[model samples]
Target: MRAARFRPGACLVLALVAVLAGGTQQASAETSPNLAIDAPPSAVVMTAPLDPSPGTLLTFSVAVTPGTNPTSTGLYVNCDLSWLGLGPSAPLFDDGTNGDPTAGDLTFTVQATIPSGTKPGTRLGDCGVFDAESRSASTSYSVNVVPAATDVGPSVTDTVPLSDATDVATDANVTITFSEAVDATGSWYALSCASSGDHTASVTGGPQSYLLDPGTDFAAGELCTVTVTA
Candidate 1:
C-alpha cells in the first residue's frame, strides 16, 4: 500500500485549538471584584441615651451594611408602656423613607415622646430594620425614669402648743406633707409609735397633708418615735 497524504485542514484545526487554550489561560490569570458588604460586628447597637422623664424626646440611629444595594429599607420600633395599664398603646415615630433599598451606608433617625404618667422605673423597648433587598435586623434597649419623691410625713410648721404646765399634754398631734398633691380620698397616712402600738391616722385640711391623732397617751420625759408610711 502507498503512504496517504493528510490535508492542510488538520493543521488549521490544531492552530485554532492552540489559540483557544491561550485565551483560557489568560482569563484564569485575571482578578475578581468583591461584591459583598462588610457588616458590623453587631448589626444594631445602642445609638443614643435614654430619656429621664416621661414625655421627654428620645432619638436613636441604626447602622447597616448590605452585601448589595437593597431594594427597600426602613426602621420600626416597638414601645411598651403597659406598666401604666390605663391608657393607649405606646406610639412609634420614624424618620426614614419606608421603601428605598438601593442605597448603601444609610443612617436613619427615630424619635418618640415618652408617654406621660409613665411609672418610675426601667422601661424596655425594641427596634428593627428591614431591607427588602436583604433580610430584617432588630435590637432592643431600656429607658430609665426616676420616681418623684414627696414628703408624706407630719410637720409642725404652723401649729401652736398649748400653754400652762397642768394643761400641757405629753402627747402631740402629728402632721404629714405629701410629695405631690394627691387625692385625699385615694391617699391616706400610717403612723406607728416606737413605744406605743398602732395609732389612728387622719387627713385634715388639704389633700397634701395628713394629721395623726394619738390613740394612746405618752409618758412624760420618755422618748417616742413616729413613722409615717404612705
Candidate 2:
C-alpha cells in the first residue's frame, strides 16, 4: 500500500523585476562618433502603487531633474525581470501617453501588467537617459511588488505517483507541484514504512516543484506512506 499526503506550505514573497526600454517618441537610436553621451538624470523619482497584486495592470512613473536636455532625443527606464521568471523589459514614456501627465516633461511613465505568479516583495532595477545616437547612462531604482490585501496561500495543483498508488516501485521518488511558487524555507517531509518502521527521505527541487528521495528502498510488501508539508 502506498499513500500520499499534502500540507499547505508558507508563501514565499519574491519580486517582479521590470526592465525599462526606450520610449516610443525617441528617435531611432543610431551610433554616431560625434554623439554626446548625456549624463543620467540629475535626479530620479519613481512613482508606483503601494501594493500591487500579480496580473494587475499598473502604471510606473519616473521623473527626473533638468527636464530639458537639448542633445537628448528621449529618456527611458532600463531594467530586467526575466531572471526572476517574470515578464520581459518595457519602456517608460515622457510623451503624455501611457499615463504620462505631460508630454516633453522629464516625468516618464508607462502602463504595464504585473506578470501573473509574481511573488510579493521589493523589485529593484535601473533608469537612464538616451541620445538619438543610442548612447545611454543610468541610475538604480526599486519598486515594491506587494500581494493583494485579501490574499490566499499557495495550493497543490498536481503530484506524481497518483494518490493511493499500489505496488509502487521501491525506488520511486515523490514529486509535488504547486499553483504558485512556494517559500519552502522551513518545509519538511517524511516517509513511513509499515514493515520497516520509520524511514527518512531527502527533499529537493524548486519554487513550484519539490522532489523527495528515500535514503533506502522501501520494504517489498508493506504499506508505504509519504507525507509532505510545504
lDDT of each: 0.51, 0.67
Candidate 1 lDDT by residue in tens digits, 1-230: 99989879998999999999998988887755657663422245343344466656555455544423433444333334344342233433333333222233455444555567777787665555555444555566666776544536543333223212233355777655555555555434454435554566444666665565666665565444444334
lDDT of 2 at 197: 73
- Prediction 1 TM-score vs. true: 0.33
Q: Give the runs in model 2 whose Cα sits over 4 Å from its true position.
A: 1-40, 66-77, 81-89, 133-135, 151-230
Which pairs in model 1 have colliding backbones? 37-67, 70-101, 71-101, 72-101, 150-179, 151-177, 153-176, 154-175, 154-176
lDDT of 2 by residue, 148-178 (tens): 6666778878778777788889788888888
Query: What is the Å distance of residue 147 in model 1 from its true position?
Result: 1.4
Candidate 1 clashes: the total is: 9
| lDDT value, residue 201 of candidate 1 | 48
Give candidate 2's error at residue 18 in angstroms. Answer: 68
Q: In candidate 1, which residue ranges exceed 4 Å CA deviation? A: 1-27, 31-51, 54-67, 70-117, 149-230
User: Highest lDDT: which candidate?
Assistant: 2
Scored against the true structure, residue 171 in model 1 reaches a CA lDDT of 70
